[model samples]
Target: MAEMRLIKKGAEAELYLTDWMGLKAVLKRRIKKGYRNPDLDSYVRGSRTSNEAKLLSEARRLGVPTPVVYSVDKRNCEIVMSYIDAPPLKRFVDGMDPEGLALTFSRVGEMVGRLHRGGIVHGDLTTSNIIPYSGLLYLIDFGLGEHSSDIESRGVDIHLMRRALESSHHEVSSEAYLSFIEGYRGVMGDLSDPVLRRVDAIRRRGRYVDVNHRKEA
Candidate 1:
């Protein structure tokens, strides 16, 4: 086993930086759960690890720039993939020129549309999942990804991206998000319209909750 240093530990998996075949790689290992039966836990973790590997591979085959999956060990619930050496889009957004940000945002939108067209839903579309390297965008972390042809699922994908922008970079995020929409509309067109509508509905729901809380306070 190659020595791997832990990078980040989440509820489900621990991300490690490791060396593989002379290239830098990421090792995602599902943490063992004692709360569930061992057999059930193993089944769930193995299934998720396998599913993500297939989804990522398909994304690459379809021309989406996701990390190249190196290997999957179902027994261990581990997946190894190429480690992106670039900062995530969220980090770069702070230092991006207006023009660069606009271009990046457009590229992100186009990438998302392409994924949708290919019948894949990223499930999680946060800026952190987008890595900007060598002036290109690479989508990462397909932990929640799935194959779906439903327009609502695709709309939810866009809505999640919008929510991520609002939460991470409010003012500039809005313009950048609009640029994403512009790019998405260029390709996905009316297919994304339902998702845009859902974005509005989600925002209203949030505002309603906020207003009620304020009134009570």
Candidate 2:
């Protein structure tokens, strides 16, 4: 219970900037849902808290840069981890020249590729969850991630990244995504082909759904 300052609050959790064992840390506490049964809520939160911690450690073990996990308090549904003192990639990617942007995203793609190759999928693959620090891209917030090597799961990761870029970095989305693909291919090689194909198929399905919704409208 070190002196804490609220940093970010989301629907499911709240992030607090605090010190842990005299080191800078971020404490993520899953919030309770008033509507859910108290026991169920506690169980759900505790399960997710444990799972996220495991995913973070696994990702780091696979050589992806991630914040070091300091502690986990399942009863309270809290995890205290190293605080990454850098901007999220969503903000960091802004104002970079085309070359820099390409290089940066290429690296992003490689990191993700490494994760996928290691049988993991970042369920939430948005730039907002990424940090570029000390010449490395640090992946953070594994709350939504899991160990999955299925084609659909892997495709969803790439699709989510593309959608995130298009929504947040529209002006440079296409170029950035292409560069990402290049780097991803470099690591995944033949394995990347099927996933890329799956991405295309997923995109088409999305477009079809959008068209149907438009028709209904």
Candidate 3:
């Protein structure tokens, strides 16, 4: 076993930077939740750990850039995977010129299109979960992702992305989103139409809810 140094400690898991068979790796161990029954907690952690590993591998098979999964330990509720040595896209895209921002987000859109075309929906699609490495945008943290090809699922993915950009990259959100739509259409072509329409529907639904809340207030 290699010496592991703790890197990130999130609410659900802990990340350790370590080495595996001469390869730099990250070990993600799901923490046991005290609020749940011991048996339930164990089962949940094991299943999620296994599922995330499977999703990571599946995304790679779909030709999307992601960290190569090295190993999975269901017993320990942990996954050992290749570590991407790049800042998250959230920080990487900050202060980028318009042309560069458009290019970067278009690639991101293409990657998401590939995933959706392959029947995968990233439930938590955010720039923080993406890393730009080796001239490719690598998506990470599939713990919330699942296999789904429905229009609603794909629309939610794009909707979440748009909201993320609006909240985190507002300065360039409009242009970035347009570029994303362009690349998404380039990949999905006719299939992209329905999903894009659904995104607009979802946005309108959000606005409706917000309007109701404000009216009540």
TM-score, one value per model:
0.85, 0.90, 0.90
Clashes of each: 0, 0, 0
Per-residue alpha-carbon lDDT of candidate 3 for residues 1-217, written as tens digits (9 for 90 to 100): 6999999998899999999999999999999999999999998898888889999999999999888999999999999999998789899677799899889889889999999999999888999999988888899989878889999999999999999999998888899999999989988889999999899778778455342344533
C-alpha displacement of 34 in model 1, angstroms?
5.9
TM-score of 1: 0.85
- Candidate 3 stretches greater than 4 Å from native: 35-40, 210-217
Off by over 4 Å in 1: 33-44, 202-217
Clashes by residue pair, model 1? none
Kindly list the per-residue Cα lDDT of model 2 for residues 8-126, writing each as its tens digit: 99889999999998999999999999999999999889888998999999999999999999999988999999999888989867799989999998999999999999999988998
Residue range 1-217, candidate 1, lDDT tens digits:
5889999887889999998898899999998999999989988898889888999999988778988899899889999999988777888787788898888899899998899889999989999889888767899878688999786678778878988888898868888998999998888887777777766656567455342344533
- Candidate 3 C-alpha error for residue 175, in Å: 1.5
State the local distance difference test value for candidate 2: 0.91
Q: In model 1, where is the ten-residue run with the lowest total lDDT?
A: 208-217
* TM-score, candidate number 3: 0.90
lDDT minimum window of 10 residues, candidate 3: 208-217
lDDT of each: 0.85, 0.91, 0.90
**In candidate 2, how many clashes are counted?**
0
